[model samples]
Target: MSTLDQSRYLATPIPGPRSQELIDRKAAAVSRGIGNTMPVYAARAFGGIVEDVDGNRLIDLGSGIAVTTIGNSSPRVVDAVRRQAAEFTHTCFMITPYEGYVAVAEHLNRLTPGTGEKRSALFNSGSEAVENAIKIARSYTGKSAVVSFDHAYHGRTNLTMALTAKSMPYKHGFGPFAPEIYRAPLSYPFRDGEFGKEIATDGALAAKRALTVIDKQVGADNLAAVLIEPIQGEGGFIVPADGFLPALQGWCRDNNVVFIADEVQTGFARTGAMFACEHEGIEPDLIVTAKGIADGLPLSAVTGRAEIMDAPHVSGLGGTYGGNPIACAAALATIETIEADGLVERAREIETLMKDRLGRLQAEDDRIGDVRGRGAMIAMEFVKPGTLEPDAELTRALCAGCHAAGVIVLSCGTFGNVVRFLPPLTISDDLLVEGLDVLELVLKDL
Candidate 1:
């Protein structure tokens, strides 16, 4: 058992003297483009607690943007990394090759949502994984056009910048991006004007409308793949209505378009399932995974059908540091910990607790327009009371309040009006409830 205490303890104010000093130093030393949600500097983090340089322990609800689903500094991951480092840190898988890399690929091939023959190639980040998946799809199909949805956030790279939907921070003035990428409408049940309250019953129709746009605008014969997040992360944690994913997957199959599920923030037991696509029984041709894959170590993967994955030639898919031995070891141990500790079930339990508490909050506050998501990946969208108008100002205020009270929260959405919660699976019930209590108090004040 771990000895780390999971609780919030504010010694001084948030960003106390030590952290404030570091923040000042950071302004002078670091780039201005890098943004931070909280001003505190972490001394250490374990399980659900982040101990700042000033000794203030804050409840971590963001999990470093869903990168530590198993937990920050999880023992298994630390142990594996240490053992691998003691043996050898980096041989560069391309040059020397390592068993850990093969083992991780084998595990991903078996674990990702398919029973058929599958293969995986590791990468350094989600953007790299997504880029490689697109390359493989285009190579296999001999097509140039690719499709992504509105409100999607793939990454910051040139190709992924073209794929991402939001523009302000990720893509503004960063164009001209890669060509042949088309945008489609996602099945957003809350804001779909056509169906309104009946969106749940109109999921199939919503999907057909989006597909119709693609069919007419891009044409089926010219498209290489259709990429999407199983449950969008930075795009407000939007979970499509039932039948939406299935309809899209069926259309992709009919049109011979590779259906790619970007599970960067929704994979590895974070969504009460191994992968979010599994929840809807939609098997994607290529699945891009990262964030939670290696317990915070930089690791990503593109796992998919053997036929498509094998389309690339020798030296066609790999990077110098793509599958670092330490990261591979960490991933293997992290996957072991998730399975042995039953974190998938823990995620479902978190969903129940969060929904019960946040649902009551929604009932009491009309400004909370919608409370949606799955497993530990839940979010609340703020709107003008009784109206669909997004309230970004209210969202900012609520997040600031939480930060001041020694709780870590994060905001997302194209409009920046959604508060997302992605707590580690190892968090205790009491600590989770305490975090929720802070949020409830903040909401009441607003």
Candidate 2:
């Protein structure tokens, strides 16, 4: 028997009664800083569907912002979480290390794409992981400068906020950011009107331009790390043209700079391989990960070559709740599920499905300007017909229409004009097709 459920709701309208009550209370009680992505209040979720308090069932395409790649409430993950909680939950790894934490680290070191003497460190969120990676890189190289790119969304912490390039809400009013952090151009082939070209030539030119900026501003000798998201998450799921990662890796190596891949959104088999960098056969000096590592648990990690990581002093790295036992256990189980169930291959299958369906939509509608991304981390860009200008208005309308039609999709990009898809790898084909159908209907209106 299949372990799945697909019962649609009988309710007339979403956020019918109970959800509205919670929304009213929440708005009054909670800080507005905590943004709401969807109107419906989640009561429960399983497989690929979320049930709201109002008894409305909707297909979840965002997967809690790409954190639940293996699906919510998987038997292995739930049992592991329950068992660990029952035994013991809090024992700071710093005070007394545990087996689960070490095991998870071992797994990360072995799995992350790189052939070197590897070591790993754990943290609470993507932001924490990124910050710690910077610390390690600086300590190792004795350098002061870090470089990022335009439209990148690193995190909300002060340091990451400075590293991040977006403004308003993320960076606005939070400045006089950390010194020694800089920004460069991203290889947005589509926006540059260079799509359908050889990925090597297009991507190499972009990387060369960034190298020029680094040499002129920071001087390669002053740089500690060049941090990049192999596949940018908040920046429109922007997959750099092919050859971009390899070219950047070469530049970093030549300049004696540590290359850091922020794999927080693209790791754990969310892409076809275990890591997005694998697609290019490139190895980063440091790899930062989170999100799908522990099936919703608050866990993140920094794995890389041991020399750089160990350069920090004896007590240079650690946190009180860095590797909570429950999260460690969940991570162990999540990795097991990914291996045993062949979810990496499953992610590739999702890519094929999305391309076939979204490609058809683009063929029919001029607003569907671009369909891009790899594996299950997919996105589409909306543009005015026969023009390169972004149509953020159309993107918002499409997202709103999808929400009303019982599909939850997310809009991203510096201009807020790209719809990114991050459905769970285990999402059933029937439901996935239904969600895509709903998205197509919305595009029809546009």
Q: Single out the weakest 10-residue window by summed lDDT for candidate 2.
A: 1-10
Instruction: List where candidate 2 sits over 4 angstroms from the true fold.
Output: 1-4, 194-201
On residues 279-391, what C-alpha lDDT tens digit does candidate 2 reach at each position?
Answer: 99999999999999999999999999999889999989999999899999999999999999999999999999999999988898887788989999999998889887899
TM-score of each: 0.98, 0.97
Error of 2 at 98 (Å): 0.7
lDDT of all predictions: 0.94, 0.89
Mind sharing the TM-score for model 1?
A: 0.98
Stretch of 10 with least lDDT, candidate 1: 193-202
Return the top candidate by lDDT.
1
Evaluate candidate 2 by giving its C-alpha RMSD to the native, one decimal: 1.8
